[model samples]
Target: MKRYPTVLTIAGSDSGGGAGIQADLKTFAALGAYGTAAITALTAQNTQGVRAIHAVPAAFLREQLEAVFEDITIDAVKIGMINTVDVVEVIAGVLDRFQPPFVVFDPVMVATSGAKLILDETVGVLKTQLFPRATLITPNLDEARMLLKKPIESVDQMREAAEELIAQGCRAVLLKGGHLVAARLYDVLAVRGEATQVFESEYIASKNVHGTGCTLSSAIATYLALGHALTEAVSLAKAYVSGAIQAGKDITTGQGSGPLNHSYAPKPMQIRS
Candidate 1:
């Protein structure tokens, strides 16, 4: 029997539809994967900023996970905004039980609009519980700084941070350098027992960068679900994101930062035997 490359997104809901669960699902569809979602939190937000957050209970989250995993064979999972310690524990436990093939953890701490997303207390729990389970931890400069408690101002620091993050128990790290002030943006990838590799793209000067992290991680998960190796998955995901950003540069979605044009080059859903 043939099946669609199915990827699940465990994250929050963005009413704005640019980032979080919405972005994850969009990226998955754009990259030819079937997307499912379990909402951890719901944010009343727009491209301008997050106004309010309503968290889903841990028990409900557990139910969502069990319902999906018991029926659908999830190929990969893209994790985003976990707003509380309980949510972290629930997701970590579910992952342990199901053991999905690929888990892309996008440590979403801050919004592109400069709003804090995750609680300070939840940070430690995420590191301890989810880091080890993640196939790849994708963190931008600001999120990396919060996790490492140090400055990551240059490409050198980005490379070093990827290795340092690997010491925290993750199989790999893709330290995103989009936040750095430079002509070219670099994302450093460091896998356990392998040399670090760097992915570079020209800095696209645009305000439509709201969901870049979520889009990139979800794209990676989708590619992984579609049978790409980890390194190749990251490379292809980067290209997809760069193209999305470039294609959406001139488009306006809101009063503030806009979203990537996810449907710019959508592919038909992929299938596997």
Candidate 2:
């Protein structure tokens, strides 16, 4: 029997089902990979905003990671929303020990409602421990600005910020430009000592961009698990996300910012034969 490529999400649980582990699993299934998760925290949140967050203990988080690594074959990983410095350190230790083939990190700091998800101290831990281990780090404009400790208001500035992040030990950086003022959306992918790749698409005016960054990173992990090159995985993920945004434009899920149609380019799961 041929086994399906498996992708894992080591992140928080979103009760809203629009982001975090839920979104990552949906994206993996839609992209033809089997999905697994090791939740680091539980968040009581909806489309409007996050109301409460209860973080799991670091030891419990480690147990979850060990359980998956001991049994399942995880081909790739997508990490999001580690709320504390301890949790971040625990995850970093696990990843360093196991070393998954492809790891995509979505540095989720602020929620759609403008509430901070990760504590300030945790950001430093993330930069020092986790960023260097990621195959790709996806940060939106605001998140990038915070990480670089500077303002990024233009394409030129975005390029420079990406360079700075690469210097900070990230293998590659995908600086999302959705927050910039432009008719077209631009995301810059920069790898160390390589030319930057710009991915551009027509800006689709829609309110259904809730979990876009999470979905994109998950999609890229799925494609990477399926043997696609890094550049190809990112390119395909961008197209998939754009289609999902367009598909869910008018459809309203909640009162606030809604989620993207993760199944926009759905593929059948690769069943074992």
Candidate 3:
């Protein structure tokens, strides 16, 4: 029997269908990887904002992980929207045991609409325990500031923040500059012992940007599962997201911020040779 790259996303469920596990699954399918998920929370959310969050029991979350690991060879894993320290601990435990080849962590601390998605105290554990295990951790300006306890308002600051995050023990950091007001968007990738690589794209103007961070991180995982180098995976993922945003830029979905066009141009499944 033929096999293919498989990716797992550990995140919350978004009823909006634009972000969280929904976006991760769409991104994985679009990028030619089999997708699996272990949802950590069930969020009452939509395009506008998150109303409430119901976190799954950490034991139940662990069970979900065991089920996937027992039968699937997860080539890569992308983590998002882990709302509590318990969930963080659960993820760290399973990952340490299985040790996937690539892990992309999008620290989903805040929502696109400025709602807080996690407890403030959980940030400390995430940095010390979770970030260090990731192949790359993608954080936008607000999330970066929250993690660093300061402001990051420019590309230069983003570069500095990326390095600082690396100092916290992560293998690499991808500081997203999407919130910086600029003609171009620059995402800084700082890997240990390697020169920083800046990935750029023309910033598309649109409200359909919800789930973009999740999408990018998941795409990175998918490409990594497909055997792309870390930098190449990041580059391809950014391009994929930019195209997805442009494809649905003018279209309207919900009354608030809508989702990216993840399936705008899908790729065929990749079969392992």
* Count of clashes in candidate 2: 0
Better of 2 and 3 by TM-score: 3
lDDT of 3 by residue, 1-273 (tens): 789899999999999999999999999999899999999999999999999999999999999999999899999999999878998999999999998998999999999989889997899999988988998999999998988898888788889999998888989999999998889989999999999888888989999999999999999999999999998898999999999999989989899999999999999999985
Residue 251 error, candidate 3, Å: 1.3
| Candidate 1 lDDT tens digits, 67-151 | 9999999999999999899999999999999999999999999998888989899999998999999999999999999999999
lDDT, candidates in the order shown: 0.93, 0.91, 0.93
User: TM-scores of all models?
Assistant: 0.98, 0.97, 0.98
Candidate 2 local lDDT, 1-273, one digit each (tens): 578999999888889989999999999999899999999889999999999999999999999999999888889999998889888888888888888999999999998789899889899899989999999999999899888889998888888899889998999999999999998888999999899988888999998888888999999999999889999999999988888899989898989999998887789997654
Q: Point out the worst 10-residue segment of candidate 3 by lDDT.
A: 148-157
Residue-pair clashes per candidate: 0, 0, 0
